[model samples]
Target chain A: MSIFSNLGIRGSILGLAAIVTGIGVTRSCDGGGIVTSQHRVDLTFWNGFTGPDGRRMLEIIRDFNRENPDIQVSMQRMDWATYYNKLMVAAMDQRGPQLFVVHASTLPRMYRSGFIENSARLYSGSDPIPSADYDPYVLQQVKFKDQYAGVPLDIHPQGMYTNAEMLRAAGIQQPPADKASFMRALRLLTKKSNSGDASQWAFALTLWRNNFQSLIPQFRGRYLKPNGDADLNNPGNIAALQFLGDLSREKLIPPPENGLGWVGYRQKKVAMVWDGVYMLGDLLRLQGLDYVAAPIPQIGPQPGTMADSHVLCIRKGLSEAQRTGAETFIRYLSKNSIRWAAAGQVPARRSVRQTPEFASMPVQSAFARQIPFMMYPPRTPVLFEVTLEIDQAVEKVIRGNADAKTALDLANVNAQRGIDRDRAEQKIAPAGGIQP
Target chain B: MQRTGFLFLAPYAVSFAIFVILPIVVSFVLSFMRFDLTAQSSAGFVGFDNYREALQDNYFWSAVKATLLFALMIVPGLLVIGLSMALGMNAMARGQAAVRALVFLPGMLNIAVTGILWQWFFNGEFGLFNFALKHFGGQGQPWLSDKAFAMPSIVLMSVWWTVGGTAIILLTALQQIPGMYFEAAALDGASTTRMFRYITLPLLKPVMSFVVVTTSIAGFQMFGQAFMLTRGGPELSTRGVAQYIYETAFNSYRMGYGAAMSWLLFALISVFGIFQIRMMRRPA
Candidate 1:
């Protein structure tokens, strides 16, 4: 300070300022060198392909990462058990993966929840797929409230499996084509002579919901009309219910206690079953099991069969670049859907189905044929509630909980109430929307 | 001494506070809000609304009924099977360990695997169960798909997988009983059944209480069998509360509602659980 008094206070202040500036400049440079201006983007993809399917998806993702160095995409394959959990967390946190795969059947809730984006923008302006290229039913299945909420990937329809050996032994050389033939084939195949006098169905039905829903279209029944309203009381629905009841009553299908359809079919205990394509992998592994896939033989007035689809969709609210990247990946999978077929699903791209490569595959092509006729449940936001009630009601009916009409009637009531209540609640919901 | 005790509990306190207490508090609070999955950060308070909706939900009730039904069928049966097996094994000293391991081995496998394995076993035709029934001249029953039979079938599978665990627990309890009890009963001219009823059962009460409550809790949260085998079908007969909450929170993106349902189940379990706790506190 004595030296500073001679030099003046300003000189000392200048020295202090210079030192502080030098330190700040050095720190800024050190930090900025690493984080300067190179922006890195993360694209997260979430899916529930926790099997060989998951591994295949991983391989594809690995290739994608290898090819693209700038954008890093992280693929998370989760078990179905906690998939929705992961999605919900991501959604609630507003850090959702850029892309995700969802079962088409459950997307209604996702759509209503606003977890998915309307992707029509890509296809609207001169998309490769002519609207006519898609199956009418599937085209319809892809929408929610007139918005193209999802992009279709695969149709995992219910196929009636014929135990070849059992059917042949029953003197049936050909699988049933319709209700009459189905009855005859079943009658000939099922022999209760071993189990009991009372036991009639040599056929067993498992996972009655799948069995019932698939039959809904056959009976000209739908869980609801297209716009999320109850249509259980419709004649088509009734006819389907009657057939199911008749099948149970006539002992054409065993009450669930007996090995249900797949178990019974694999064991060669039952001659027939209606099950999803997902059952193919398990059936293929059954040591002595030999079965053939066929259309769930049109039992009702319409030839339509029931099914659930797996959809590939972009998570809502991604950036333009992320959306573009996601669209690229989605298109890649859609084109290369044959890989998905190995996982026991029917791919959605019409070209995939027509390919000699795909058609030659034993079950994929035959099952794929049913895609055109496959009936998805109505694409209503409240589809889950309606389906759940119908499923429960159907079970009770089959379990003799109620008569076919009465059961369905009650189911109708429950479905409407659920739809109504859900709408009312949705209306009242703080406008932020569904979390996952 | 109190300080030492506090020091000893420090690690547990930190873990419990972080893992259990914090998550519970978060879940409870989240249950009151309208959680938006797509909004990223848009959540607002909607107090008691989720609770009201969940309470009004028929499927929620269906799930509750199903879960209770599962507990009702499985808990008692598991306890009985476990005790019987434990007693049977205890009486056999030669291959006891081997038999014990064999009985307990299924529990070691996952529930999904167990579900699949038993799906085959209880299968109508090729299932070992129906196969045995047929071999024994009994009628084959549709085990997994029949609404009337599906839940019971699941209970049967659950017991098969879990009886081993209960057996192990009860076996530990049985072993803890001094040899003198059995010897005294034998000298007192007690029949095997009488000895079990009077002496063995009375001594096994604590284990029984533990086994019952634990098994019931497990049964109440039953998911794998329903998820893997029936998928809450042959109708929602097998739809347990856990599946419902899981689906609502995750599948439906209805976190608030799911939280509400879970709390409801929590309350239900607490009522049953408190009784078990009280029973276990009895002076033995």
Candidate 2:
């Protein structure tokens, strides 16, 4: 009888342990992860629309959830910096979201990291997003080593935004047509000893990675050689740098110290600046400022522009039913991304791009003109590192801290080493193996 | 005696062995291997190649230089100011508790918020630093735009936020110095500086060593301020080992390389940590 009672106690302890394990497993599955049941499809959707855009996204997700309660879609919104970090961690752990958003430039890195699903079957055979419905350039941006997978969501291209009153005061009747015209425009608009002398400057450029890369193409210089080495040391690149350096040095534009591009333009201290549709919300809120958007004037023999986009992808680990749910949810979002366009993005779907709504938005439409000529940095696994290297080089050059050639040379050396390191890393995967 | 000692140590031994010792050993060994961060995994024995490459790489050395520069800037400054505050607090002054809390408040604030606040404060156009300069009938110099100013800005921000914790530690050490010691110094007709030098400095060495080692370790681990404020820029002037490690691990997904950096940084910190340990055990 005593032995029976001891056996009963051991059995009860084992049952409690099992119960604890069940709860642990439930927490991962009930909301943010793969569903246990084949009958109930749970979807995890991630994006970086944490701005005012997030509210609209939440509303859309709410509508979707209300209509299709069977397929529960959990909208995970993180900030831009942390969004990618979380996705990469989830992918590394082999328990990622069913669907997520990433920049077009970042897609290559994600693909290489095995954070993205490579199989065509996941989204190809009868998936709601047909390949033909996307703009070719936008579609091309999300391809992984020539393997197209990410459903392109939006196009965010760099364009010239001007303060109309400032431009008119400079006696410029029209926006500049070419590099020379642009230079003259800059010279005319920029007034140093003017009324707001110490406080204001004119014709500010948002000099950073996006705008830096955009300027390269305008100088008739390539950002990268066909062999994938940086081409910033070329003569065209030199001339372009000199012109920009001259602008800041000669007092035709604000020095690196005056980092008031968007704000100065909005407040009417500056005449012109270049940025993406992301800044449209800032402009829309500005009052009493007569502003207009225009296609950036040709900088070189080739008319090149900066266009970045966000690509939606799936995490590596999930059941077959979960993958299907994720794909369906991506298709649903892509189909209904027009609401997203109203918030600032140009819808990635071609049909949506051709609609009256897209045509009506002046800034978005002007930004869209350069779609065929748009370029991003090399879509490699090391692209993000390369961008950092470029930023270092650009800062040195812009601050007059280092010459353009020396800075570019240093950048090239660093980029090459990064590429080599990346190759070495890819050659050595850790542990035995992780499941898909 | 043996049995009682074992009983007292068993739980701690088990925990230390599991959490600390195991991870340290595994990671140390793993540092000499190569691995990818992904669902599909395979690891290769890399020997001392990761360390060799890190030594040879300019970026790594640049990171090292930046870290050392940061350590040099923060460590002594933190100690001097912290101990000074502690001395002030050790006196039975009015509002001592309130002053301690006020001094300690910055350390409790989030690093991200601190960076943003400082960024605005240092902004050339609308920043408070420039605003104050204009008030003095002076020109606004770029506080964070110039590479020279960038490092100083980050260091200043870090100093403001962290000195409080260090002060608290020093204050406790001051309290423990004993009223009898001070009275004895008074009897000897020793000046205030002499008392601090002879009595206070020697007794405080233990806690001083503790403060130095922990702060040194934290100095190398600086990331959020650089990441948030200048992004290690104006031109990579402010990037440190922790930021580089993070970029490698998460941004690049080169987990093996990142691990290699971690162990390398561990060795770097340990060398300093051991020195502090020796200093504490010294004849003084």
Candidate 3:
């Protein structure tokens, strides 16, 4: 009797395990088969838009699905910090989404990995988004080695956000437009407490990298030389660094630290801060705070600011039908990007920007004025490493640990070493031309 | 009966091979190759070149230094603080269970939650700590921004988050010690300190050694706390080797180099493990 009962238990356990495995396999296979059997093209879209913008994108995706029954587009969103790592791994394993988003600045690295399709071919479809419809500078961002690498969706530039209440208390009506006026405003708005600590300030360097990058271009600081070497310590860049360091040295800005500078501005403790246009939605959600946006003040000799775009890219290795479907979805998103603009981004297409709907977004309109002169970081495959070096140098100078010149010189050496290593690994001949 | 037992173990054995063993084996092979994901066509056997580069890399050395400094801070803190809490709990006359449960509660919170909560507390401008300090006529210190304070702040959060579980383990071991031994020591005119040092500690040696080794191992592998808190910053002063490896491999796409560093870290942990075992072993 005991032996018979044990046999019965073993049979049931085996049956249960087999049933579970079968269900798992069949469920996954069923998803694919049902779509394909109906002659529908299934497209997976991935992006890192886990904010208010994510909701906007989801609504658009829903509209697209309802409008286009032939294509099934599934969207997945994650935080941007870990998104690129996950995307690259998925692409490497050939299990990537059919459609995805890549930052224009990250195109070169993604391109080098051979996963991005030549998006120029996407224009061959019906109802294509004309190349001329996009802002030229914005279009140039997604172009790599004479090929259009991705479709530009929106441009997010670093601009000045001001506390109107604090500025009014300081007797400033208009934001600074140029370098001299900016310095005057800084002096006028800065205040000290009884303990000799800065209680209110004209400006806070929120993202030091973007702040430095914005200043560098205004000073005509070239990050890369014609010879493909890093020029981080050039005269223009050093002057920009000195300007930033002076802000800290003069107690116009707080020390480079962990405090949320934006929070200070929202609470009316800070007069102004330089952040990206993406912060518009956040500020709008904050009630009882009077804030406004303006073009970044001319800290250098000319007008310029740092900007990057979210580009739509199709994964390689898709079927012809899948490719066509992905392109159709991208073009649809581009055509209707005024919806995207409501989520606090400047649409990349000039036609879209010129529309009445986009004009009504006051914050987007202010930031969009600088689209003609927005500077992206150097378009290198090793951009991440280069930016790390830049950030380290900028932090050292701002924190008063090292002088601007010394820090930049060290950073120059480090950046050049990284670029040289990258070049050697790729087997590109140094300086002049390719090896014979 | 034999067949049924084998069948019962097969699922776990299969998963272990596929998930754990396979990755280790693949990474070992990858460490010897030139596996740059961006330029995959150029991948080939480089035979220890990745390891050689790591030895000469300044960033790698800095990362190693940060990891060691963090381990040194957290391990001893965990041991001392955890033991004190355990001793206190063991000496309690009533509500010991409730107290033990309360002590272990923080460990149940997720690492990300712990990090975010502490980040708010450590914020220099408008943080809770700074607000309290200002009320007392004191100035706020740059807790997460200064290189000197960043790691210590991370350690403080880690102790609050992790020491609870360690204390519970120690408390369990403490409860196992016979009350008669302590009674005898007291009857012999032994002081409380002497009783603790001579009777309690000697009995708790094995558990203590286990705790030390495990905490040290966990400390060396620290990533999430520092990643979320300082982001290896105030100038990469808090970037541990694990974060460095992550950036190198995934961010830079230098898989071979990253795998090489991973092995180097593993070797480092093993060396510490051996040394700790030797030091903690009871006299033969």
Candidate 4:
């Protein structure tokens, strides 16, 4: 109060504004001043790798920082569940990091919102990681409109994790590769109590969304029409859901519950579980458990499995030097993706996958064998809502609460409504034109 | 003197204005606008469109139903358990302070820790509860997964986690009741039951009303327990309004719609609070 009296009210307001402006100015100039004085560019990177993979990523970042004296990339990590919300809020405030990681399926929403930088420029020029190096299917997921939105780092596809000891006990030498053998193995391995309760199951549906999505495509079901309409109620998808329902009805699989499926598999109460390569580290930590990774047994007509990638993206509207530095870091990560794969991932780059070291990782190599047929969920701005609807549908069917046709039909309507709302909010025309 | 008083209040006043009042005002304004974070350019005045959409939204209704169900389950249980625990502790002749501390311990745990601990207990297979059941030759109940059990299971965990705080408040209120009143009643040859009915219950009425209203409000705003336990699963049976609003605002980025629903929930809580206060204030 005495200070305010001395300076006067207007003078105090001006002083406060000046202080704020001074702080802002120093923050804005810090990067440039350091770059000009020491010839070093500082880049901020953010990602949701808050697991075993995070340690691996931290190691890589440290190595990059040590090797590249001219560039400093500081990394921040958070859990994936809340990561997108924080990233979006920061982006809206124009405080987004220069480099970030996003799942390939999430790119559409970010791209549509104009949050991500169009990375087509990185594809050209000297020492570029060529587009040919990535699997075309995985690379295509990062493409939005006519521009590439990000670079794929690694593919994490869901594969069948089998209890090898349980299979051997059932007198089966090899894991099932197709529908008939798979059913036979299930029948042999499943144990029932006198009261008709399943004491042990042959398979437990872990991550039901991925399991259903993988099976639907193998059954020749299209998740979306070419024109971007939901095709969830199609015959092929119905058949897929029916098959999953039958498994529950027959007591071959237990009802999907929290931590039950994975815990059951670990305790040898279940024989097989379809989960992602990210779980390999957790499985490996368990002693005296013999496990093997194989392609999800072919349940339908063709070989297919659900896959997602962790892609590296840049925020829009960076200075030219900043862009260059971010690009260089992305290229370094891409080239060194083999080390990323060591954290239980399939390297996105074909050259990295071909390396003998990658082949030596049995689980990763087994999952990699299905790279050619891996199917990602439909790329849509409203994919989150779509996924929730699909998850609900699958849960209902697997729980024997609703018949497949009814659940799929209801989910189809709900998903279409979400898509329509998204289109209306974004002022986007219906699908024969540019996707919303 | 006034200047010194203002100086003393300045820190709290400034923070309250910035963090609490400002957000309420902003969200009030945002409720009328189409404030989709994903499409910033599309934000504009929509004049009750968001509210209308919430009225038509089935999930909104379901969330409301779930929240009300949770409130019904939790509020009565909290009041009964809290009062009983407080009375029991007050009647203790020895180790009163230690018993009170033991009762209050769970309330000190963070919600996340509480949720995880209870989640381990409620896991259908390989959980402490199920393991105990197997040991006793009983079949394990689907604690978190089934539609019928999910909300009740969450309520059980929440009661364990939060009852301590409520009981402590009631205990303080119990201790504040003068010994003179009970002595006077004893001189009148009143039985223990009659004394409790006439003296203790009457004296504790105001505090009981406070606890009931606040507990009901907190129950209506329940999110963490259900979120950590079932994640609104077994077909969205346990998903409360707060969780739905969170998903709408943060997950779906529909700020306007979320704010609209939040105001509706606020209105519902206010109505319930007023009703409870009025009912509790009436002489039985």
Candidate 5:
């Protein structure tokens, strides 16, 4: 009944292989002579860095191309909003770039797509990129079954962005670092008008998913178990949600429905917000806004924040020269990552972070302090579904539609159903079935 | 002659088979299987499971409800506004073209631009709508974030974005209704309202049926306006079935489920279309 069956799996595979080999042969010849004397390996690098960060990445790639004569790396930038979909399609068609960038949290899904090269290939050279430079926790995110999926480039961790003028007006000289002081500062900064409406807000939930990811771990809980089962309604998660709900209930912050807190902070009305370090570019563009960046305060028994890294990934099934060129370019980028850090991220390489140039960046350095304890979303192929459930539950709790336990309980059930469905589907799937 | 006609139809037929007909057939087959993109090696038949899963899926049902609610708001709004505009333009002795062009301007802009433009208007903190409300001594309304207001806000934007094209189509149909009918009714000393009710309403029934069926179909498939505005937020209250299918197939990589939902939506649209035609075909 199926068309693939009419062609036969082996027949289709042979047809696909012939087409791929034809394309590869033509592409591999697209180098040498016109631009340079030597036979260069032209590597196409794709990434979703279409912001101010894109400019910095362009500069880094240009520098790398100038430095390396035999390997030419051309970069393509796309918006992160639609990047993964495009990447997946390109990979499926076997037209993917030689090298690409994926977020550390997205590594699992991309790995399952079966297009990424193992990390062993990245470290196979005589002068390998040292594994010692990266934090094991960050490294662990890219690992799958004793092999690494990609190389971690930089960590963008959520940190406290505070309006210094508002804090000073409230008689606070330093940023809050713990729960007691954080609450004290919040109360001191909050002002009420005659009608009891909030005149000046103390804090705001900027991005609920990011804020939830940061807070849930501070309360010492997991959204997904080690086996990738839903664990959203844990006691610590409930406590964390209740704490945030109280902030809204007491009017210490506006409810999530009002607007984005980042906008309020930009207008200098909200005193503080926990946001990613990548937001530094937006703040720097604002005129006359006095702000300070610090690590997110420990509000619930521990210090933690959500972090995601840009990982350098090599596409699977490249020629030996292309693979080597990809690894070489990745090594060059890793060594020169301080420039990437300057663009608004914490360099994942410890040696790069320890440099004086990186230390000079107050926000990056402050956010870097949380790298040891930073939380990456659970590595699961069903991550998108799980996150959707968590986002809905958090929104429900913060918007007062349901209590924390009730909302998360519903989310837990929904996410668990998704996991179960995926498992059941996989179990019945025939081995070596045709790829669409 | 037949061979020559076949040659003329060959290009279109070939493309139709490749792009449209083939995909439909493949997806129909895919709906009864497990076709996970991430696990291509494991893809296989699982008869009726995807459909069964969708029937029990809460999110799927919510998506259906959201889409139905959207259709309920938009279809009637388009008909009333479009019919009213056509009637107004028909009565105009001068500046009819100018008024018609003005009514059609918003429809010319792409959905992305319209969505983004209206998103700025609906933003609670600094939106133009909120700014105007505050200037009038009214409190700011959380346009896209309140469950009570979110779908209505989306409907309001949808009306502005699409009513122009609908008005233009109805206006063309209005112009086709000959002046002789009204004149004949006038000879009988019939009142304007009476003539319009008896003649205009009956003549317009076929076009009105066309409008209603097409509008309902488009409304059910709505994705861009809500996606660009609230991202189906305020706890997914505005997320329609199309967006849910997109997320399931592309974002979640569950191709079988997405295809199954797509067939279900196709069935729903077909049912509504047939019901509309049947109801409209009845004698006045």
Candidate 6:
């Protein structure tokens, strides 16, 4: 009753109707109550899949609705930019959907906020989603303490996009796989004119945050530790930044301005770019540009790249039937996520990736090669604050305001302060704490 | 008759109370409480702690600096451009209506459309400005990406988007001045510049004051232009106080901190508003 007060009197009546309907369906199963196939468990689903991926998700939802006569799921989609704010507000007010999608990186904040349910029970039930199908790292991201916060759907990782024509023109037969080959390709592909200006560039940095993050791990550095502490101010991180900074200084790559580096690739002025697998769709839409996708070159000691997953989450405080309906919907979506990968995502399920059809996807299959070594941002409730500091630090380094070490050092201090603030606040409230 | 009049006012009064007054009151109370919407523990009164924290927060100060910088750039820019356009149109005896409408046209566009259109023009790599610059053998300027140019770039777009409305207002005010005073000064052996300075300037003081007060208030509350253009990026140098407050509340889920900042912004706007009115009240 108190929860419904925020909705006003008329809304409270509608809320009561929804609860009664859930109860009515439950009572029908007790044997004496009226049972009808017309009584379907209606569930609302929300996601930030407003792009081409949304059509694939809609098809899955339609299939689920068709297959399950007793359950119907309706989905709402919005741009990722404003989706989290709306979801947070709605969930806080007890007006959120029965099911929703959150990025795996966002799970820590969402779980600590108390708006998401612990999904451990769903994985333990009679028909459970195969936990073995997911990578341990991906699975760990969806866990808060020992409880599962959500289920992974797919992972999107950074992949190196190469211009095949440019590669051929430069007398390169295959994409570069190491620092030696990459630098050689960059030098060979670069074209200079009589006027001392480079008419064509070798590479450009798009989405600085993601680009730098992917590089940091390749250099044997981690942005955040397993326990979610800031590890940005490290030698590996500094080396990664210095490598990119040197490239910009040497004119091997364009300066990180406008964040429109993809435009250069599309225009055939640049030979290579390191961007996310999700950008494959846009590249595919180009009329004449022949491009190939491969794992980002190993610039450091070992192979590493940045990856993030779309996690299927259930809202807290749902009726039993709605919760069950949501779990079933998640399982259906996860099993059929090969279709989701058609929009350029790599399905998180190992079995799904092993399928012949999944291998047929040129971009997705190539990007999937680095999934074993991919990393996500720190799993902290203060993820937003931490990311904010990282973005600024990365920007400062790229814009030539500060060197890599200085920028990362400042960011580390600020990020640590943010973590401390969050810890202190959690101590005061303790309600959202997952620790026993 | 009295009851019917009360009925007519009741709907508006109720809506005003619910939408405007209620939110203001709630925000005021929330400003003093440690209220995080995401946290499990209920809101507790923490009185002035949030306010003190805001004062000490570097991000808050930087955001305030960005906002103040925006206001400083935009208020004068709008006034000068708007006044010049108004005076130019005022001098034109023929086709005044079409020219006035043409000058006021950009104001009709939504901020989203305006921001997007300008974003393409300001983009460094593929922007229209750079495209044209390259054609003329000029270097491409990093309009929105460079910290030095980001706020000014937003102000430029804002002036283009909004100057027409301000010009129209000043044009209306310019037309309202009595012609007799100018004519009398002209007949009294006064030169064009002197007559303008004495008669035109004195008569436009009230309207100028109104424009200043209103433009300053609008400038102080600016959010959409920068938000759409740069998202207060390039190291958060373009982030205004309003954007910061929004990010605090919505993105960070720090409700009490957000509310406290909002109240602080409100107080700052009020103080500036009052000071402008007072300054403008004096005879210029």
Residue pairs with colliding backbones in model 2 are A218-A299, A218-A300, A429-B42, A430-B36, A430-B42
Every model's DockQ: 0.34, 0.54, 0.66, 0.51, 0.69, 0.62
Docking class of 5: medium
Index of the highest-DockQ prediction: 5
Count of backbone clashes, every candidate in sequence: 18, 5, 0, 0, 0, 0
Residue pairs with colliding backbones in model 5 are none
Identify the candidate with maximal lDDT. 4
- The interface root-mean-square deviations, each candidate in sequence, come to 3.9, 2.2, 1.5, 1.9, 1.3, 1.9
For candidate 5, the share of real interface contacts preserved is: 0.70
Instruction: Kindly report which residue stretches of model 6 are placed more than 4 angstroms away from their true locations once superposed.
Output: A1-38, A193-197, A225-228, A428-436
Candidate order, DockQ descending: 5, 3, 6, 2, 4, 1
Model 3 lDDT tens row, A261-370: 78778777788899999998889788888887999999888888999999999877776677888888998999999999999999988999999988888899999999
* Model 1 alpha-carbon miss at residue A145, Å: 5.9
Clashes of 6: 0
DockQ, candidate no. 6? 0.62
Task: Give candidate 5's error at residue B170 in angstroms.
Answer: 1.1
Pairs that collide in candidate 6 are none
- Score candidate 1 by TM-score against the native: 0.77
Cα lDDT tens digits for candidate 4, A56-78 = 99999999999988889988999
Off by over 4 Å in 3: A1-34, A37-39, A124-126, A432-436, B282-284
lDDT tens digits by residue: candidate 1, A102-210: 7776676666556677877645664444456567677666776567766787788888777777777778887788878887877676666542642334467766777
Chain A TM per prediction: 0.82, 0.86, 0.91, 0.92, 0.89, 0.88
